[model samples]
Structures are given as C-alpha cells and as structure tokens.
Target: MSDATSPVPAAAPVARKVTSIGLGLLAVGGALSAWAFFDEDLRTRFGFGYMVGFTFAWAIVLGSLFFVALQHATASVWSVVLRRVAEMLASPMLILAVLYIPLLLVALLHPDSTIFPWRNPTSEMAEHAVHVKGSYLNETGFLVRTALFFSIWIFFTWFFVRGSLNQDGGRRADITERLRKFSGPFIILFAFTATFASFDWLMSLEPNWFSTIYGVYVFGGITLSALAAITLALSALKRSGLIAPELIRKDHLYSLGGLLFAFTCFWGYIAFSQYMLIWYANMPEETIYYTKRLSNGWAGVTVALAFVRFVIPFLFLLSRQVKTDERKLGMISIFILFGQLFDLYWLVMPNSFGEAGPGFGIPELGPVLFFCGVLLVAYGRFVRRHPVVAMGDPHFEASRGFRLH
Candidate 1:
C-alpha cells in the first residue's frame, strides 16, 4: 500500500519548466516550417518532410493513448502510478488534430503535387495500380476517413482523461469500474482506426506499394516509441525531484525498461516479417517498397535504423542493473525516440527523393521541432493542471508496493 495518503501532490513547478522549453521550440520550429512553404516549387519536398515530422510525433502520441487503454482494459496494478503520465502524454491528440488541418489543406489543394501521386497521376502512374485504387484513394474519401479517425481518438481520450481526473484524490471508485468496462471496446476501436490511419497517411504515400501488415508494423513502432517516451518522462520527473523516489520505485522503472526491451523485439519482428514475406513472394508491387529503401543511399539508413532501434537497445537493456539505473535507461530511451523519427523519415522520405537518395536539412528539422514543441507544451500544461499520479485509483496503493519477484 502507498505510504502517502489522500490528496496527491501537484506538479506545477515541473510543468512550468516543461512548458517554457516547449514554447521556445514551438516558435522556432513553427517559423522554419512556415519558411519552407513560401517557395511553391519547394513545397512538395518540404511538405513531404513535414509529413515525416508529423508522423514521427503522432505515432508517439497515438501510441500513448493505446498504453492508457491497455492499462485500464487489463486492470494492471503496476502501472497505476505511471498511468497519469501516459494520460498526459496522450492528451496531445487534440493538438495533432489541429496540426493535421494544414496537411489536409495540402491534400485538398495540391492533389497533383508529387506528395500524393493519385492527386495528379502521370501517364505511367495512370496505367499502374493507382487506377484500381482510385475509388478508395480519392481526396473526398481521404478527408472523410481522416475525420472518422480523429473523432474516434478524441472521444476516447476525453473519456479516459476526464474520467481519471474526476476520480482524483479519493473520489468514487465506481468511475474506475466504468472506465475499465469501456476500455476493452476502446481498444477494439483503436486497432481499426490506427490501422486505417496508417493505410491512409503513410501507406498511401506509396500508392503502388501495399502491405497487409503495414498497420501492424506501424503499431509496433507506435507502442515501442510510446514506451520509450514514457520512460524518458518518468526519468526526467525523478531526476528533477518532481516524482518522489517512493512514488516511483526501482521495480516500476525496471518494468518500464523491460517493456522497452520487449517492444524493441516486437518492432524488429514485425519489420523482418514484412520484409521476409515480401522477399519470398518476389512480387513486383510489394518488392518495390523494399527496393527503394534497400538500394543506394537509402540502404545505409535502413541498416542504421535496424541497429539503432533494435540491436543496440536489445543488447543494452538485457542486464537487470541497466533496467533499474535511471541514467543508463534514460539514455537509451532518447535513442529509441530518435530511432522512431528516423524510421518515419526512412518510410516517408524515400518516396519523395526516389533514386536521388535521402535528403535532410532545414525543411526536415522545422516540422520535427514544431511537433516536439506541441507535445512538450501539451504534456506540461496537463501536468500543471492536475495531479501527476492517479491518487484516486483504487489500485494506486497496491502500485506503490509493486516489485519484481
């Protein structure tokens, strides 16, 4: 049981620091991203870069939402203390909904732009697979589907965050039961929405290339990246003395590390499975996706992604000592986040560059920094406004005693 009682401590001081940094990054990243759009000719290149930044950030946010849902559905006790942080991490889904508008405008206004070939299919593209997929890939369908995806996300986020907040500081535990009951259904909704969203946003980038498991592939990254992000946040709170050592124990930290290790493996497994299936089939349409990524300048990025995202973390996190050590685990969490960005960059950039190879510069950095700012500000604001721990949860006391056997 928890040694601490009743009213949970507030996180205002930490919130201020996080929000300040977030605002600064938001300004700079917003300015640079805006500058990239001025030159119409460069719009296609930078627009695609913007997609990379957006996806990199959104994956983490959406993944955090999944984490919250999973906790409630499984009634997991160990994560009760940490669930508030995950809830805060996920609160940014609304922000992403707004950020998505500009991209949608681009989709609506510049369909002919190289970013989406279906908008203005070329002579060769006209005869290819783009033709058959026209009904599903049209601009209107894209817009409607985007709306559906965001609606599902917003409703669930509100339900969980609001419900949890309402239950703060020894309130009725019935709300907990209510949340738990609905969590299973929320996850079912998450799977369908996340899968289709991946299909619409990322997979559609390469209309000709299709993967039945693409959504699963992105899900692996999303959950893995979300866990890494959560680990980083908890580590920061611990180091800053915002989260008392007693509230978040070494067992909790170890659990976080073990999750990171497991998901890294999961992501790697999905990645290899997708590639292996495609390779074995030797189908031109599917193979083209790997071909672009595997050859020339892009090849190095693929190799680097696998090593940094999987192999390095897999080996480093194996030791029990490393999982419990804040500094050591924090360092890898940072890298895992970077790997998530690089993985998205790898997925989105190659299509824009084609045989010219990978391109990275101001255009790429702008959107990334912009989304980073948005996330920081959102999370900070959430922490500032509410309790950092789920003190109202019936399971909160048991979570304090959570330990590995």
Candidate 2:
C-alpha cells in the first residue's frame, strides 16, 4: 500500500515545540516533597510521602499504558489508527524508569520505618508475621528485588522505544519484524515486573496483609487512569494542531471511553472482591488492614471513592452520546484522573496515617507536583524526537476505518 493508504508512515519527521510548563510544575513540586520528607511532624511527613509516591506512581501508570497501546499497535490490526497515540504514551517509560532513583534512595535510607514495618527490628506490630516473611521483606532482600524490577523495566522500555524510533528512521523491514518479535516477551516481562512492584510498594505497607488479587486490582486501576490521561493528552495535542483531526474521530474517542468505563468497573469489582474475600475469611492478619481503614477518618475517603470512582462515573458514562462527544469525554476523563488520585490516596495514606484523618497538606501536594514535572520533562523530550503517529504500520487503512460494533 502507498503511504496515503497505509496506516503506518515511512520516515516522516514532525516538529514539536519545547514547552517547559510541565518542568516548572515539577521543580516547585519537588521542593515541596523534599520539605515534607524532612519535616519533624509524622502527620505532615506522611502526607508529603503519600503525595510523592502518588505522583511517581501516576507517571508509571501513564508509561505502562503507553506500553500497552504499543503492544496493540504492533500486534493487532484493529489498533493501527490508535497506534501512534500509544507510541506517544509509551515514549515516557524511559524517563519513568530513571526517576526511580529518588524512590530507591527513600527505600534505602529509611528501610526500617518509612513504609516497610518489617524493616525495624524492635517493632511488635508485625513481630510474628515479620519473623515469617523476613527472608523476603528485609532491607537486603527489598533492595535486590527493587533493583531487579527497575532493571527489567528499563531494559524493556529502551528496547521497545528504540525499535520504534528506528522504524521512523527508515530501517529495513527486518527491524520492524524484530520489534514485533520482541514485543511478546517484553509484555510477559512487564506483567511479572508490574505485579512484583505493586506488591513491594503498596501491598507491603501492611506486611502481614497478603492478597493474590491485589496486583490485578492495582493493574486495573492504573490501566483505567492511564487511559484517562491519554484521552486528555490527545485532546490537548489536537487543540494545539499537532495531530491531524482526520486521524482522531468520534469512533476513536468512543473506543477509548468504552475502555475507560470497562476498567472502572473492573477496578471496583477487584477491590470489592478482595474486601469480600478478606471479610469472609475473617483472618486477623487480613482483617486488620480493613479494620484500620474502616475505623479511622479513612472511612469517609473510602465512601468518596465508592461514589466518585465507581458510581458517579459509572452512571454518567452509561450514555452512548457521552462516550463519543470529545468535550464530554474530556470532562469525564478529568473526573477519572482525579478519582484515580483519590483511589491511590485511599490505598497508601491509611497505611501511613491510619484512621487519624485524611488531609492534603504540602507533604501530599509537593511530591505530586515533582513527579508530574518529571513526566513532563520526559514526555517533552520524546515528542521532540518522533512524529506523533506510527506511519509505517501495515494496517493503517483498517485503523482509520475503525468503528464501534
């Protein structure tokens, strides 16, 4: 097929302006995170730690979504039109991997008390459980696991991104085939790494608590959040006239919106299922996690998530018209994004502050801004190097013609 007929492009280079707004936000956010981290007050420090963690976690979500899109783009004929968008999203993974340095520092310097309770030798809180899981949750073990996780993420992201960029530079068909071959194994690696990463960072907050489904629940939440972020980014890019309107139609918007809705439901189901299982089993170790959340000010936050993340959006997005309308979809996207923040807050904050109460002080806001800034800096650089679309895919024709069934 000719360039016009094919969904993928040859060697078309697109110009993207250098916008430092995201970077500026990151700088201010980082300063706030640092101040919160060192503050003497536990409540204040916990709030900031939550913010910092959430900010970085959101960046990971975005990057992972990008990777998921690329998987579809390279493998599925249905995704040719949306492939470029996925590529744009995946481009930031490299930076997300690099930004792990600070988190590593946090995990290393304060292994005993910051997030992992088992790190402390004197804590009676998980004394029995800690003794059991000490082999895996210890400072030395955690460092090894974390290093392995980042190493895998960094390798896959670089390999996938570099391969796509090479295609843009007019590499031979063999290179394209090589990328397709690599994607399958890369995805498998991602699945394992993401699961382990979630367990270490979030689930381990209550080391005694264990759930096989926690990783899946987190994956669902991150996927939904990432889709919302992609929609917002695509809308913003289109507004700037960077992407061709012909390439992005109501059909595309509908597909994305539908996926968002589906995942929202999936996240809720997984969350409730985990709770139900724990509640039914009534194991003291597992029940304590929810018990803490239910008693403290955290109960109110949980109610908010039930309404904002699931119920409200679930009802609002039920309409066919809402999914296809760009303006409406964009607004809903904003809602989902905020809901995601709340969802993470609910998950991490309680572990840090218990049921004392929920608050969004500098400790919370600063890290969020800092990580957001890091994301912008990375995304900005990616855009500057490549076209917003995948011009070389053989299935571009089918992608442009994609429609809702």
Candidate 3:
C-alpha cells in the first residue's frame, strides 16, 4: 500500500451504493420536513425547526473537519487507513449550503419574532438592555454573517477534498505536504468559525442570554461526535469487506477511544463550568437560560445528559480492553452520536418553546433524516473518486505495520 507505483483499485461501485442510500434518505427526510412545515401543530412544537436544520447541517461539517485536524495533530497511522473516511465527511458541506435556504426564508419572512428575539425592534424583548448591547444580532447582520460562514466552510471543504482526490491521480509527495501546510491555518479558522457559528445559531435563541465558553462547549461536542462518526464509518467499510482487517489494528481503536475519553471530559468540564458560573453569579439574565431548562419538560433532558453523555460513556470507555476492541468501540460510538444529538436538542429546544416538552417527532426527525441523507450521498461520491487509503503517502508503510503496544 505504501509503494507509490502500486495499483489503486477504483472505488466507483462502492461510491454509487453509498450515494444511492444517501439520496434515498435525503428524499425521505426531506418529505418529512416538508410535512412538518405544513402541519401547524408539529411545526409549533418543534419551533426550532430552522435552527435544528442549520445546526445539524453545520455539525456534520464541523465534525468532519475536526476529525481531519485530529488526524494531523496525532500523526496516527490507524487513521491513515481511514483518513479518506474522515475527509469524505466534509462532502456534506455543499448540501448543507443548500439546506440553508429554509433558514434564510425564516429570517427574511419573520424578521422580528422568529428565532432571534433581537430582530424585532418594537417588541419588549428587544428593549431589554442585554439584547440592545449586541449590534450583530439584528436580522440583516444575521443573514450576512451566515452567508459569510457558509462561504468559508464551503471553500475549505472543496480545497481539502479536492487535494485528496488529486492524489488519486498520482500526485507527488508535495501534494500531501501541501495538505499538511494548509492544515494548521485551517484548524485555527475552524476553531474561530465553529465558536461564532454556535453563538450565532444556538445562543441567539435567547438574545438576552450569553456565555463566553459556549463556543468551546459546542466544539467539544462536535469533536466527540466526529470521532464517533469515524468509528462508525470504519466499521461499515469493514462490514462491507472492502477494508483489510489487518490494516486497522487494536492500537488504532485505542487511540480513537482515548480521544473520545478526553473530549468527553472536556465537554463535561465546559458544561459544568458554564452552569456553575451562572449559578454562583445568580444574575437574572444569565440564570434565565438555566431556569428555562430546569422547569417544564426540559428537566428530563438535563438529567439525560448527566447520565447518558457523561457518566455512562465515561465509565464504559475507561477500560483498555473496551477501548481496543473494534466492536465495543463502535457500539460506544453509536451511543455518543445519539447522546450528542440529544445534547443539541436540549440546548436549542428549550428556548424554542418555553414549557413545551422535547419529543423526537416529525419536526425533529424530518430535518435529521433529510440532512443525514445528504451526508450519505455526498460522502459516497467522495469515496468513489479516491482510493480508500493514501497509496502514495510517505507514511503509508508506517501505517501498515502500526502496533498497539
């Protein structure tokens, strides 16, 4: 696999299968979302429909990009066998760009009372001192900022993925070096964009409420989710019998598991720190965010995060055996992915409906399915164009002989 002259098998058929499934899911999910839009009750209950769509779409993009960064940061070989898998994750950014249509519609049509309360100039909510303090929370500013965000994301997705595809055409070592060079700057840009993106999309739900660490909190979740996604993708490829079992060793699993553990801790720390600061300060403005979640049906979600997101995974992944076993790691990945979704739901839903309970009804399921479909199709297309591994990569031999201990 390391030989530059080695023949690389074409990935067209597999790519097509992946694309078909992705498109099929998108159609089904899109239909559900369409129905939710027309169904007044469902739409009202899932009041954060637009926000959910935006967040889910962006989450996948950020998650995939974060995986790329981690791969570079650790210089791990196990992931070399799966680097393409991680790179393909970014393919959804294009589809997500289109998904923003509905969000743009919501902002344009309901400038005042929609998700961002600050949009409504005459509303009493807008008169509050906190809302007035932020000049960027307005309707026009929101649209402009969103457009800029998507543009930057789409550009990086194209550049990075394009370079990988070019490598399949027998590019030199310099091509890989170019990617590494771009990686540093890309990571920095990703950190800033991801933070502000969370603030703009999720935090603005309650214009008066703000947290300095909220961006880092969201990044932690995104990173964890991306790792889960990578594990799942690798498992799927193995199941398909396309990936060589020997290529992915227990050491790789352990490394990925360790990353999951580290981020799990980081997410908990951020969540607790934010909560504690607000609790100690007892400021009405800051405390109001927690107040809404603690009351009504949102309280259940809070408890779910405490146990599902942190405690359970924390204990389960603590073992070296569990971390190194692919099947066990894959199962834990699935759990973490679902937990992250629930975490996002807990964050956005409370503000959408003050006392309304959180349910995985059409409003929630529709966007999730739709975006998921898009992700599948895009990733499939990417995989089809490139070799599953970097055959010409200088480190390919090192990756092949990678060991755990």
Best by TM-score: 1
- Alpha carbon deviation, residue 302, candidate 1 (Å): 1.1
**Model 1: per-residue Cα lDDT over 1-405, one tens digit each:** 121321324466677789899999999999988888777766777788788888888888889889999999999999999898888888888889998988876645664566776766564566568989999988889999999999999999899999999988566789989999999999999999999999999999888889999999999989988999899998887777767778988999999999999999999999999999999999998899989998868889999999988899899999999999989999999999998998898889898788998888777889899999999998877776777778889998899999888
Candidate 2 global Cα RMSD: 4.8
Worst 10 residues of 3 by lDDT: 1-10
TM-score (C-alpha) between model 2 and the true structure: 0.88
Ranking by lDDT: 1, 3, 2
In order of appearance, the predictions have TM-scores of 0.95, 0.88, 0.91
TM-score of 3: 0.91
Clashing pairs in model 1, backbone N/Cα/C closer than 3 A: none
Judging by lDDT, tell me the better candidate of 2 and 3.
Answer: 3
RMSD of each: 3.4, 4.8, 3.6
CA error at residue 15 for candidate 3, angstroms: 4.0
Query: What stretches of model 3 exceed 4 Å from their correct place?
Result: 1-17, 40-47, 73-78, 111-113
Would you list the C-alpha lDDT of every candidate in the order shown?
0.86, 0.69, 0.76
